[model samples]
Target: MPRAILDGTVLAESPNTVVIEGNHYFPDESVNHEHLTGTATETVCYWKGTARYYSAVVSETVFRDIAWYYPDPSQEAASIKNYVAFGRPVQVEL
Candidate 1:
């Protein structure tokens, strides 16, 4: 199983993941909502469509734009819709 963690707090974990561009995208249901909050941040991928972000707060420390998912992905990247991916400060334990 693979898990997304921040300061030892598990954010998301799943045996099934979609790998794109070397990033592991976990299913929406696998995420631990208590550690994340949606933000206004969004970025567009030329082929994957728009990505919405979430911030993680662990022990009162805020890590912004640490997780992202495409709520509505393009046809080419539809498999990843609703799948979350962690970046940078967030660690993915395999």
Candidate 2:
């Protein structure tokens, strides 16, 4: 199993994460919703489709758009649709 931790909190823990390149994609429900503040930031991945982002807020400190997910992933990466993935500085433990 692998877990994504940030700001000393475990955001996600799962065994069914999809690894694309080196990033672990945890199902949306696996993430800690309380720590997320939805944002308008988005990026497009040529093969993975459009990605939506969420800022990670810890106490009074805010990490802008530190997590992302593909709401509508392409066919080649459909397995990770709506899966959340963390960015650097967020610890990923296996």
Question: Which candidate leads the pack in lDDT?
Answer: 1
Q: Across residues 1-94, which tens digit of lDDT does each residue of candidate 2 receive?
A: 9999987888899998999989999998788899888899999999999999999877668899999999988998899999999997788999
lDDT of 1 by residue, 1-94 (tens): 9998888899999999989998999999999988899999999999999999999999999999899999999999999999999998788889
Which 10 residues in a row give candidate 2 its minimum summed lDDT?
54-63
User: Per-residue error at 4 for model 2, in Å?
Assistant: 0.6
For all candidates in order, the CA lDDT equals: 0.94, 0.90
lDDT of 2 at 11: 84
The estimated TM-scores of all candidates read 0.97, 0.95
User: Where in model 1 is the C-alpha error above 4 Å?
Assistant: none
Return the top candidate by TM-score.
1
